[model samples]
Target: MSDHLTVVDHPLVQHKLTLMRRCETSTSEFRQLLREISLLLAYEVTRDLPLTSRQIETPMCAMDAPVLEGKKLALVSILRAGNGLLDGILELIPSARVGFVGLYRDEETLEPVQYYNKLPSQIGDRACIVVDPMLATGNSSAAAIDLVKQAGGRDIRFLCLLAAPEGVARMREAHPDVPIVTASLDDRLNEKGYIVPGLGDAGDRMFGTK
Candidate 1:
């Protein structure tokens, strides 16, 4: 709570989250709203990106203007659901390098196993942002971070649409160096490892699956 977690509580972000939480939100609407909300959350998660000044000539006169410093960020998506957030964030930071960690949770054991892995070269030189919509159990997210670290990602952050208390604790224990940014930190995870009062399976809603 002190150093690791960040909840984007902006008015527009909250309002869009409420619309997304409803049972009746259509797939198209949910996707669109998520895109809109991700734009706002992007502002919060990347708030601390380093900046350096470069001399540039403006319409008025030459000035030392601020610009992003160092290599572009590496935006890593944790498989299918993560792509939802990834799309919108990419819209905002078009030059960011992209990567993916394909993982799915084992239902009975509630553990994450990797199925695919790809990362940008010189990832250690880039700040990494991992995007996944629901931080339910945190197993998959933590495992995804493990892959990122193995691939030489040093500076990393996590972003989600909703997070449960259990999931946050799990992530804190596993990767204290990585910060988490989300739309809402929810009540708890239900018996089946779903976030209580969550917007149901985000993948189902986003892809219109059962």
Candidate 2:
């Protein structure tokens, strides 16, 4: 819950990420690896969820068992690329509430421009996890977080496959309360706002788009 960032360095995650970074990796392979890796990332992100004891009858005798406390989690995807992460996470936490925040960067201004947003009515009551495959400039991610805040989202976390130093710094400065969970924190971003040594455009890679 503290203001910080978590980099998942599990072997499986690292291995899958390496494959994803390869330019020769096919679209289908990339998507498959992303799905597989996301499951591992989801495990780390929800590791600290609050739990409560519930009395349940086992096959033998009745006993108190630990169960997730409070409302179901809210999974918010930050548009296009986020959807790729969303699908995989959903497979792991199928009961979680789903939401979306749509933002696209302006080619000239290089700023986020919001286009669409829809969230659960009780977002504030749940622990929200915002998913995006890549955190580049952090402009779009920061803007998405702002919208979540305005919509009554309180306990929020950001999750991504890859992150750049610039993006991480931006998030730390803009929303220190929200923790970041990513697979890899790569080097600095390039002049064009892309993460160095990143897996190209995440959306394009996943969907075979230009």
Which 10-residue window in model 2 sums to the lowest lDDT?
Answer: 1-10
**Residue-level lDDT tens digits of model 1 in 1-210:** 468998888999999999999999999999999899988999999999999999999999999999999999999998899999999999999999999999998899889989999999999999999999999999999999998999888999999999999999999999999999999999999888999898999999999997
Superposed model 1: Cα runs more than 4 Å off: none
TM-score of each: 0.98, 0.98
lDDT by candidate, in order shown: 0.94, 0.93
Candidate 2 per-residue C-alpha lDDT over 122-176 given as tens digits, one digit per residue, 9 for 90 to 100: 8999999999999998999999999999999999999999999899999999999
**Pairs of residues clashing in candidate 2:** none
**Which candidate achieves the best lDDT against the true structure?**
1
Candidate 2: misplaced stretches above 4 Å? 1-3
